[model samples]
Target chain A: MMHALILPLLFPLFAGAALLLGHRLPLPAKRGFSLLATLALVPVALWLLLLAGDGQLRLYAMGDWQPPFGIVLLLDRLSALLLLLNAVLASFAMLYACRGDDERGPNFHALFQFQLLGINGAFLTGDLFNLFVFFEILLISSYTLLLHGQGPARVRSGIHYVVLNLLGSALFLVGVSLLYGLLGTLNMADLAVRVAEMDAGSAPLVAAAGYLLLIVFGLKAAILPLHFWLPRAYAAATAPVAALFAIMTKVGLYAILRVFTLIYGSEAGPLANMVSDWLWPLALVTLAVGVFGALASRGLQTTIGHLVVVSVGTLLAGLALGSQAGLAAALYYLLHTTLVSGGLFLLADLIARQRGALGALLVSAPALRQPLLLGLVFFAGAISVVGLPPFSGFFGKLMLLQAVPPGPDALLFWPVLLVGGLGMLIALSRTGSLIFWRAEGEPVAERADGLRLLAAVGLLLGSVLLVLLARPIIAYLQATAAQLLDLQPYLAIIRGGEA
Target chain B: MEAVLAVTLGVMVTCGVYLILRARVFPVVVGLTLISYAVNLFIFSMGRLATGAPAVIGKSASHVDPLPQALVLTAIVIGFAMTAFVVVLALRGLGELKTDHVDGQEPRE
Candidate 1:
């Protein structure tokens, strides 16, 4: 029945609808409902994962409408895998947020559920305009969450964050419009077919459209030069909010990979190559700047924010390499970064709690119950971020390096790679020492609930599991990459109308 | 002729860049709005302009690309939402802190 295809989105959608009634419920009930609803997503996600492994694909059309006219939901191995991750991450983060002594209000739970709806919708929607609608839903919920707690700094920074993203959304709209104008359809599969049929006279227009689209995606992904808004925004957002944002970049990366592979493969246009080439140096710069920003920050939260940027930069570099092997590495690293960054942000929140508040965490050194956990988490995250081994990061980089053909300029990549690695190490050393080791002057306080700690552990341990499961993961990534390169299957689905 | 519109858009972008670089919050908001306008126009231009053709499709006649128009329509609505949100945020800042500075009153050392 392909029910697996619809469950992930439906679970969130129905849960969110129920949440609109949650405001009338008691706070405890509201929190309970949200957590239960989020946890309900897990089983469906797992089933979808199973279906994806069996080489099954599902496409759901709105209101029995045909493609090139109506919105569509597509389920592929890549989308299923990411959808599951989003549900799992959100469930854990909700558990963390809804825990005792810090229970969020009804609106918080409602907004959170809707946020998941938007995020999952964005991941699964095959129609570009539908993607935009879902992005707005996600962004709007995020804006509310970002400014949920009342404070001058959060409120102020929240505005800036909203403004910047609003601009990105506007850019996204423009890009999508241009894409629609060039082609007759906003359906991705249709666009892909039409894009491949472009003649020389229309080539420049297509290229421009493609580049503009990349710019919008790149900004959302926090690729270098467009990243000025990230650290500040992440630094100021509450811990759970920041943790949710940790995977937002994955959405952007997902869009880039999806659009380029599905609609604008190498043969379709020069835009793909141009984007890949242009991103390399900027990614290196983003890596450098992020590491340095981390080094410069005194607060655990701000430092971790910078670290997220560095990982994003590294992912972009891998993405820009534009080979199946490189994409495989990128896919692996993308999952790794989401887990590690999500974990570290949780740790940062815990550390912030230990110091009383984020501002206090910056001024006073926190004494954690398991001080060793901080160091251990930092070590694993740093190792992964820096591409050091026994971890998945090293193996992913190894795959990427192996894929770079023996071009004359191949040696040039090494310096940027080395410097980025070193920068990661330096940032880790500074922030780790400052937060865990050298800040002994402050009074030790009772740590927060164990659920936050558990969420962090879950994410970190899951990443270590990724390292152990590298063989299967690499196989899956390659399969997805191959699927991407062959657009005929995708074309047939949207065009053929076989349910 | 279209090149001149593109140039005007470029100049608007430059102005936005200068405003975004400023330290005041209001200027930054203004800059963001201007940048969005520029982006909207840029996207519209990418469709490769057609003469006096409406976006709606007809059975026999050629229509200017409707997709870009649809896209631009969506962008304009979303842009307004963003602008409204930003304006509300800026107004909230004015009401709460009574200042429009980029950095909050709290000092970072």
Candidate 2:
């Protein structure tokens, strides 16, 4: 099963190509095939997770070429966890898409698979340039996916998203090229080694490149100032696309964590802990801004979009702590937020569909066809998202708060995070009452689709499952964080390969 | 030669940036194309300016770094595809909203 390391990337690649070629096939067949491909990833990701659980860094050099010269995909605890997350989220999103969303545009299933391929490749790749390529793959697929349904709002947002990300891509190449020029290698491990040994004379240039990369990743992650694009783009995306996009921002956070910890980490003299000072203040403001946006938003989808930004802010805060506990807390919270936010997006879509012409706007509309069930799901999601007790969100936030050592940073983080949760609580409750309680008219639409509800509830249940399996998951994440902070194994992998 | 290449890149990027800031989609697309061109040149130059050296080894005593050439190739292809997509998207936006303005409406005069 050593070859299974490449399966995550290949399954999607082949499946996407097949779907594109067979685009004329019946929708059921395409759905069945796409669902099968996506479902298969779960176990594959699980197996990869089990493999990575053993604490050994697994490297799959493309075409059997060695690292520092050839491309390599690496699997460790962090990548495995993210792969599993993406697989699970993609599975649910794919399930939801099967209920007619895939038919909205040409090649939705193919684009989705390509998106997964890019995301999976990104998590697995250890080469900087390869990461850039994967980013483009995911991004291009995302641009099409955003415009999948073809609406005025989507085009407007799509233009901004495409143009901005194109610039981001240019910046990404510039940064990668700068690093390659300075270090003469694109392999991440080799770069880490070289960056550490780099003299002070070239420090400023490397720092510029590092910060440039940060800006690009920050744009992807939607950190505060660069975050204006997110709510519009995500809100304008179709439901399943929006659900899948919950993992997209995490990819940015993941890159930040990966590059900062691995390359510019403690061992990199003169460049050590460079992102910490910048990440801290930005995270606080992002949290505050996201909450404010959520509170002010008129539509449910946009509210959830802002909530995604809030999650980004919270996760960045956990990462900003710059400790093993902090990373572990952030990873756990990442699992919770990605799933629940995805569920909320799907749920919001369901609500929008039932509102007749009202369509996700927060105004009082006709009651939903299945108000009781949806309201229950909404209540549950709200509880989890608001960081209330007994759900994964509460525990995730608790872990993050506890992870923060008592310091000025804690003082800043505790209030901003707690208050942000309170703000979410207010926003969600207002939305729920307006949609479910304050309604005076009859239910507008027929009973909701079983598959769609299942898809949404299935993902929302992920939060509960996280709470159930909190012990082992948190333990694994702790080890992952420890592994990330401990650069020796990663650096040693290159040395081992060179020998 | 290096100074000239650097100046050209700077000029291209400046033009790209200026055009991108415009409210119109056509200008924005043109700007993006320019920027991608500048970025491609920048990546190519990262290999340093070498006129006569062969890219492949064994044919010459000193070979130019072939890596950035490969990198630039990949970047160009991706950039080309993106430009095509954005252009089509711009046309679609024009059809749907009946405006070339990025905001999907004519700015109030």
Candidate 3:
């Protein structure tokens, strides 16, 4: 049990350290080592997913210390799903990196593994301060990775990304400190128990802590007002990095859902509805702003960057509904968006490579050498992104709409989602023609590398696989959502006094 | 001790925010360091302000809870690392763009 519990963290940490040591090796050797390690995590993650899929929360107390006294890694269905998601993205991103991006800078593979370690640790840790530590680990590594294959544009955006996240980290620390001062416990399960036991008088302090946490997480997740840094930073990152980042934003959302639901959830007086009330309005505006930004974006990657913002908005809006139905929809949408957005980022990179000087700019380029193949792939990617039928995106939106109960807020949500898709359709069409259809001169692009094409196509297939396996997948997600909302099992098993 | 520490933290944070909002990169770095200092103190204060409390496990009637101290120590190390990384990044930015402006430079006419 301890082996399975600690394996996820140890695997990446050791691999990353080894990669750092072997930095003097040839590029191919380095890439191969990193690739094998990342791929190996998939099965480990899957086995754990199956183990936890039964809805039991497996708590691994580190150093054999009991709860509230030591750090712990808690595995539940939701954590398993996210670990699997991270593994899938990490594998594909590794494949994409091999096409040329890995050689863009030194120690790319090491930093990538470190980033994954931080992400997986953040997902699994049961201590709030430990989460803070993991968040820093991820952010520090991201700072370096963001600056990889350094360019003036990358550096320019990297500065803003670093400063904003530093501020967010400070806020996170402050929030955690506030909670500790008030409650004297840092273990999440213990905090939940204490919160439930608190009287009405302490509600205001919890609310302060809750709002501070919301602000920090809101910044990380790029909620509307705090979202100014994402487009520039994401657009400037290398393709594989950007693709993996599709899950990075989800980390913030995951933290929000996990903490808010488990600890400060409605079981805690006065803290029950704090985040939801503001979340709906903010999310609606986020969706609107994201769509408009996408429409205004001049480059293909920037447009995809804004599309990421749109997906975050969509997921949060569903979460704001605060029903089991809404959570189920959000979970499904998370899976859908991560894959499609990841594929689109890789697709944009492939398109840029083949398009020459036009370089993913929204303008006429000479005809691509392999138009039919690339055209077909891009069309599929665009359709999936806009949530057309027969793709996971379509089903995701359908579920969200179904989950919304008949209420006046439905008027606001329905229009934004529908209109946002419309805006997305127009943007997609315009960009599609600008690159693939407006061919006029000689065929300027060299044929793309076979491996890169295979990776991109495989991602699109992964999305399709979601469609094919919709039955079991949605069932799994619904179960995951159900487990997430029920705080009792998590509370009982890990509480300081209960056991 | 409590009121004095609170006022000090408030002053540090206010000044830090001001420096962080500056246009140049260096002051922003300093601002970040300042804010981190304030946050470090805030975390330390969670253990309460204790006088004549044993850092050891000696049988002092009210030993200052040493957990937050250990946490703040770790946080300080992490904070220093962050400051160092940003400083190098800011220097590189200045060298590359030939400007210290955070936005790199004005749009070329």
Candidate 4:
């Protein structure tokens, strides 16, 4: 059963290698292999999820070396859930990319596979250095994929994309080295145990290392001030690429959430106090900036990018609350935000095409203003994005609001939450007015095909299901949060001492 | 002992920031390179700057902290790859936009 933990990590890596090998095959054969490999992942992911439900955490030592001596891949409930989500989204994105022009479609699948491998590896790895390695794999493949088969604009944006992440990766390396120097281990669970016993005098160095690592996560998550590369990159990519990239930002939030919970606790005296103190204000600032950026968008794509920022900001704020309830809410918010953001990006593609195509198709028919079915879908998307009730976004935001503590100066989590909600509404309002309500411009002539539309509908429905199933998810999240705070289990996993 | 490394780090940060702020991407790349070097030295010193100790003990008793050195060695290799990738990305940006600004689409000179 423990071997099941390794499947999510190994499956994608093997799948990507297989795709590279079959790259020269006939188109039909290539598609079959890629789809089959991705489809094969679903049951495996489900199996791992089932295993996690049994309260059985799996740790596979790389090359049969013991923990703290060799790299490890850990599969707790949290990692299992994230790994499954990453694979599902990747497979769906691959299917959606099948609609692309031949020049871009085949190579697109290969990069999708590689990106999944990197993302899953990042989620599963137990060592800090290995996480950096996986992040590089994700970044490099994404860089190539971003530029391949796009116009000069995408190529240009890819430069900013590459430089930003490349710089982040370097900073990550520095942080890892410092951390290893200070703690004598790069294994994350080991570091957590060892760091607990470190001298108070060495706090400054540890704080620097922590901040550096935070900056890396911040860059990837597109938190305020470090998010310049995101809007342009997202807006310039093809629809499927944009959709896939939306989830990529969530991976960053996942890392930050994972690291903070695993490495530090709010109740743990001076060091924990310092981290929480700094994060709370930074999170508030990030939230304000994200909402402001979201409000500033003139286009649907940039608006979606800002939404990514807002979701991350909210997640960070939830983390900053530094309570068990806060962490659980953050987890719920992460899941909700991933679905909402991914759906909204795909909706942008649909709207763009709808406005453009209806303009062309209804050229002489002046009486028919909007494409009825498409406009209805856009309306649902707009409402969902704005966090209206009965939608997944609403539940997540509500949970976050309840979990956040009142500020010291005033009881004020609601005011900030309201501002963010308003910012989302205004952004979506502008996009809706421009795309659907306004008279159509020249037809885009670039409508999504059947497969793309199917994926979009399926994703939206899945998010609704997520809201319906919130109770169980909340229980799981609370359990995960309890485990994180417990820390004894984490220490035992690495040292084998308590066991 | 502490003051020299602090000054060196400050100088590296200054030069790196100056180079990164320049209009050309190469200088920015060079700036990134300089910053990384300073970062490495700074992180190395954070191990508390002990000397005459090898990371690995040669089947004998004298063993320095091996982890940071191992981490630094890997970091150096990864940093080189990162630098190489950025250089190639910069060249690509230059070829595409006819300028070397890392921002890539800044109003052409």
Candidate 5:
């Protein structure tokens, strides 16, 4: 069963390779194979989640070689939870893609599988360099996926996306090499231990390297200053791809949580909690800016893109609190936001498809074919996104708010979060009325695709399910956060593997 | 030797940054290529700038660290692929948008 740790990576790798090789196969066959491979991940991820729930750290050393020498995949509660999240998101995105989106471009299924391979690999690997490799894998796939249905808008955004990430990749290597130069290892657990015990002479270089890694991750996570590229790129991407990218930002947040908590965590002298102070202000500003962007945006997808930034800000605030409660809250919020935002992207696409020439712009247009059903889903998504009651978003926000120890930080967080929610409420309401009510023409005759509706609704239902399953899910996340904060089991890998 | 390497890397990075800031796609591509070169050199030197030291162990008492060599190889391959993709993307953008300007149109004079 320990081999299950590598299954997440292998399933997608093999599926993607086969899809690429079998390109000449009929479309139905390709979709079946891709769908089967993706759906298989859900069970594997769930089993891994169950295995990790036992609180034991499982290490799968490649080729029977020991850690700190061979690359290893470490599975604990956090990684397992993220793996499941990626699986669930990818499944629906794959489902959505199967509904004719795949035909818009060549190799959609293959590129998607490869993207999953990258994401799962990133979440699973315990080595820094391996994480970088996985980032490249996912990113290259994404670069192609973003341009699937080639257009002027996509290519324009793609240029910015490609150039920025290429720079980010260079910086990632610089940070990794600097750390390797100083510590003589790339395994994250070994790096954690060595960083803790390093002499003062090397501390500055290590700190520099750590900050460089932060910049790279921040670029990926789309933190405020580095976030300019996200809205354009995401909005320009095809719907299913945009929906899948909802988890992509979280990958950066996950790296921040993993690397900072394990390697440069409280146990490290002089470098303890290095990112906390910076994350606090940046998260707040990101929230504020995201709200303004959402309110000001003219397109539905771009508005949702800004809302994604808002969610990132909210999650960053939870992480900035640097508490067990905060981390657990962030993890829970992470699940809600990723699903709901993804649903919104798909829903927007569906609405745009029916609107004909208006096409998701915020102006008044013809009513959608199924106004009542689509309106209901959009309303539910909007309320949930704005952190209103009766959905998972409210609870996620409430938990994060409750986790904040009443202090100066609380003073800053409460107003920004509440005001940001209010702004989103206004933006969404205005968007809803214009698109749903203020129609200038007759409703389009063509109906929404049944499969596309199912894909979107299924994801939106994930949020409702989160509310219903809040207790068990929150408990699991709490345990996951606890495991993350307690780094002893992780550090034990390098030592135990040597024996 | 260290100073010379440092100076060369610094100049490459400076030029790369400058080129990357240009409004045109071609210079930006060149800039990215140059930066990747600088980064590769930087990673290579991180293993401590050994001359004639075997990367493989058992060939000498003190072989160079083999890890950064492996890392640089991966970086080079990835960078090369990315450069190629960006070039094609730039050409596509040029054809579709009818402008070499990154913003898809030239700024007004």
Candidate 6:
């Protein structure tokens, strides 16, 4: 049964390695291998999700070693949820990229698999140090992927992106070592136990370590002061890669959510709710900046970039609410944001191509082919993005706004959720009308890539599906949030037979 | 010995930060390399200052923790790979953009 846990990590590794070994193979073979590998992950993730659906937590110990001594991969509702989300997005990205995006680079298929491996490993690992290792894996793969087409813009952004993450990785090692030095264990469950019994004298140092780790997570999650690297990098990346990169930020959010609740929640005295205090103000600011940047930016790709930042801001703010209601709402919001954002990136690419010289700018340059159908596609994503009713974003925003209790945070969270969302709605309308509503010049006769448009539509359908499934999904997320608040089972599974 | 090592690591990181904050790409890369070295040593120090002892432990023997040593070794290899990647990325950016400043600005003559 535990083999299910290891399979997600290993399958991708082997798939990537296989692709690498068959470098001399034709495109169809490489593409087939990559697609098969990604498609296989969905079922595995679903199986794991089913196993963990009823709050089951499974721990797989590598080399038969016990916790605190050897690496362990954990599967719970949260990891399972994220793994499924990742697989779904990877499948879409693969389908979209299959239409020649992969041909831009020889090693695209291999790197794609490796990126999945890294993402899955990051989601699954229960040890703090292991998280750092997988982070490096993902970062390295992303570094190459962002430079996939090898353009100057990508290279510039890649340089900044790599440098920033490298610094973050450095801090990660420092924090991990500090925590290990203090607690004598790198296993998160063990650290939770040790942290509970921590001496008063060492509390400050432990808090500092927690703060350092949060800073690292913040950088990855694009919390302000550490977010400059993201917009440009996402904007500079090729569309398909940018679409895939949408899920990458959520990995950081997952880490933050995991580490905060597990290692420092009520289990660890004094440090409980440590980062949440600071997260509230920081996240609110991040949300504001993201929305404002969106309204101010004219380019469609840049708008998508800032829109991502907005999602991060809103999700992080919900998380900082530090209530079960808030977390469940955030999780719900996170789901649609990923789907809608990824769809929009692909949509933006198609629009840019259709507009020819204008390239996704919010100006009337030429009429796009299939303007009405594509206009509806943009409307689908736009309404969801702007948090209008009957869409996933509306459901998520409503839940989030209603979830915050009547208190100090509600004061801030309410206004930001309302006004920031309003900002998005206005920005979307302006951009939509500018490009789609008015046709001021001759239509650019770029041949429509039917497959790409269909893929973008498929992404839009996913957002609609989220709305249709909102009740059941939100119910599941509420349970997942409750499970996160309950760390006892996770600890017991890691401690094994003694429990 | 611990004090000496701590100070050395601190100095390396300080110098690395100063270099990283510079406008040039080359300095930033060098800074990243230096910072990585400090980080590697920091991870090694988690096992405590390894005195004159081989990294082998008998059933009850008092030996230094090899875990962090192994972790540092991994970090070193990754750091090297990252440094190489960044240097190449910087060089490519410079070649294409006609500038070597980290933000791609042409330096004043």
TM-score of chain B of each: 0.85, 0.96, 0.92, 0.82, 0.96, 0.91
Better of 4 and 5 by lDDT: 5
Tens-digit lDDT track for model 4 on A1-499?
2677777767668877877877887777767677777777778887877777766567888888888888999888888788777667766666766665334745656677778778888888999989988898888778877776656778788877876786787688778877877787888888887777788887778878888888999899887778778888887777667777877887887788777777765533346634566666666777777788778765678777777777777777887776788888887877777766776677667656655433212122122233565667767766776678888778778887888666661255677777878887877776565555455344435445788777776666666877788788889889876666666677778668345
List clashing residue pairs in candidate 4: A356-A443, A356-A444
Residue pairs in candidate 5 whose N, alpha carbon or C atoms collide under 3 angstroms: none
Clashes of each: 1, 0, 0, 2, 0, 0
Candidate 3 local lDDT, residue A319: 85
Clashing pairs in 6: none
C-alpha TM-score for every candidate: 0.88, 0.99, 0.98, 0.90, 0.99, 0.97
* Candidate ranking (DockQ, best to worst): 5, 2, 3, 6, 4, 1
Give interface RMSD for all predictions. Answer: 2.4, 0.7, 0.7, 2.2, 0.7, 0.9
Q: What fraction of the real A-B contacts shows up in model 4?
A: 0.55
Clashing pairs in 2: none
Candidate 4 on B57-82: residue-level lDDT in tens? 69556656665666667667777877
The DockQ for candidate 3, computed on C-alphas, is 0.83
How close is chain A of candidate 1 to the true chain A, as a TM-score? 0.93
Docking class of 2: high
TM-score of 6: 0.97
> Candidate 1 chain A: worst 10 consecutive residues by lDDT?
A356-365
Per-residue accuracy of model 1 over A332-393 as CA lDDT, tens digit each: 87887787778777777776666544332455355655667656766777776667877766
Tens digit of per-residue lDDT, candidate 3, span A80-172: 889989999889999999878998899999999999999999999999999999999899989999999998999999999999999999999
* Docking class for candidate 5: high
RMSD of 3: 1.4
TM-score of 2: 0.99
Candidate 6 C-alpha lDDT tens digits along A181-299: 88888998888888888998989988888988998999999999788888888888878788889999999999999999999987888888788888888888999999988999878
lDDT computed for candidate 4: 0.74
TM-score of chain A of each: 0.93, 0.99, 0.98, 0.93, 0.99, 0.98
Q: DockQ: which is higher, 1 or 2?
A: 2
- Model 4, residue B28: C-alpha shift (Å): 1.5
For model 2 chain A, the run of ten residues with the poorest summed lDDT: A490-499
lDDT per residue (tens digit) for residues A1-499 in model 2: 2688999999999999999999999999999999999999999999999999999999888888888778999999999999999999999999999999988888999999999999999999999999999999999999999999998999999988998899999999999999988889999999999998888898999999999999999999999899999999999999999999999999999999999999999889999989999998999999999999999999999999999999999999999888999999999999999999999999999989999998999888888888899999999999999899889999999999999999887888899889889999999999999999888689869888999999999999999999999999999999999999999988887787778
